[model samples]
Target: MVWRQHRIIRLNIVVLLYLMVCFVLCPVSAMTVSSPAEVHSVRGNAVTLTCTFTSTSRATSRMSVDWSYRPQTGGPPQAFFHFSSLAFPPQDGQFNGRVKWLGSPARGEASIQLLNASLSDNGTYTCSVRNPPDVHGSPTSQTVLTVTPKVPTVRFSDVAVLLAFILLPSAIITLALLGRMCCPPRDKSQTQGYHSPIEVTPGDEPGFKQINRKEKNMTCCDLYFLVWPFFFFCS
Candidate 1:
């Protein structure tokens, strides 16, 4: 009989535990929050942290979202952003004026953009959401935000401009010199050198003079001796 009583007590305990889970833990576990496991961003650039939630209930005015941050050194999380109908961004902290709300809670989003991210901002961020009757479940999600120093990069356009301004002119000049050397032009001096000497008659000779029509009476040799010899003797 004692053993039977012990069995009855055990059964009662089991039922009580089951009831507790259904009444207390089930509703709290209904809403689920999610976010990226890790994020990478360059310093001085904007980085977005996204958080979303699914609830068994529909959207309501009471729905709210909160975002917090924790340093890499590990400490208590600090709330920096809050949203319901209006957004309450970080006012005065490491993130002052740098955090902007980018989420629409009605669409199950709780994302925020961190402007001018810095190395000091390298840490973990947590997002929590609550919607009236659906406020329980996994209402919080955490993301590890990693801010890396911006590395200088060379752009394709800049490289193209460098090549165009420097290498292109060099290539054009090289091609012009090669063309001039390979196919020489036909100059008048080369062709004229191969021709015979110009033909010269007695009249064309500088020292020989022909008799004019008016002096046809003179013989050709007499005219030549009189005109050409006299001209040379006077000089």
Candidate 2:
């Protein structure tokens, strides 16, 4: 019984080794494609349709890539790009002289560029890569691109309207401030005249000596000298 069990174990080991060798020799059929779900672009500009892929084996001359489009308005998909060992951009129809390849096959890229994108270019784009012998996982992916018209710029009329509503009021306020700073209004109290009543008494007057014929005969200077002393004494 021991001998029989030993033989059975050896046979099982041999079978496992054979299966491992077969798996190593055969090629795997697995691949994956990657792409953005959506893209946005302004009209009359360039846009890129990004795409990438992975495979169990490296790409070769036999590998192929194709890009197609479906209008946003709804329609059947149409081919606009092709690639094998070399790129084949579209040269007919709406895509004429507009499509360009911007991918590196050595890095497993299959992206493309569209020049002068327009409103008509807004649609769904599909990228398909087939690295033969790797055909298991999904090899195709899609992205939707939207092209919007450029917005209108500010016009002279718009600027005038803004000035009328915003700058005009601002100017008026500034002018009023400057007027206050440069030419302030006068105060009423400072400009008006004011007066107060005065009181006079007869006691302030000096007792004048009655002028006789002797004083009348005196000169003007002699009379002024006599009156000056009396004026000082009265004050």
In terms of TM-score, the best-performing candidate is 1
**Which candidate's lDDT is highest?**
2
lDDT, residue 14, candidate 1: 100
TM-score for each model: 0.59, 0.58
Model 1 spans with C-alpha error above 4 angstroms: 1-29, 172-235
Q: What would the per-residue lDDT of candidate 2 be over residues 1-235, giving only the tens digit for each residue?
A: 9999999999999999999998999747699999999999999999999999998788999899999999999999999999999999887889999988998888989999999999999899999999988988999999999999999799999988987888667655654665565445645564342432244243332221222333455454554555556534532
After superposition, candidate 2 runs with Cα above 4 Å error: 1-27, 155-235
lDDT of each: 0.79, 0.82
Question: How well does model 1 score by local distance difference test?
Answer: 0.79
Model 2 gets an lDDT of: 0.82
Give, for candidate 2, the lowest lDDT window spanning 10 residues. Answer: 205-214
The TM-score measured for candidate 2 stands at: 0.58
lDDT of 2 at 21: 91
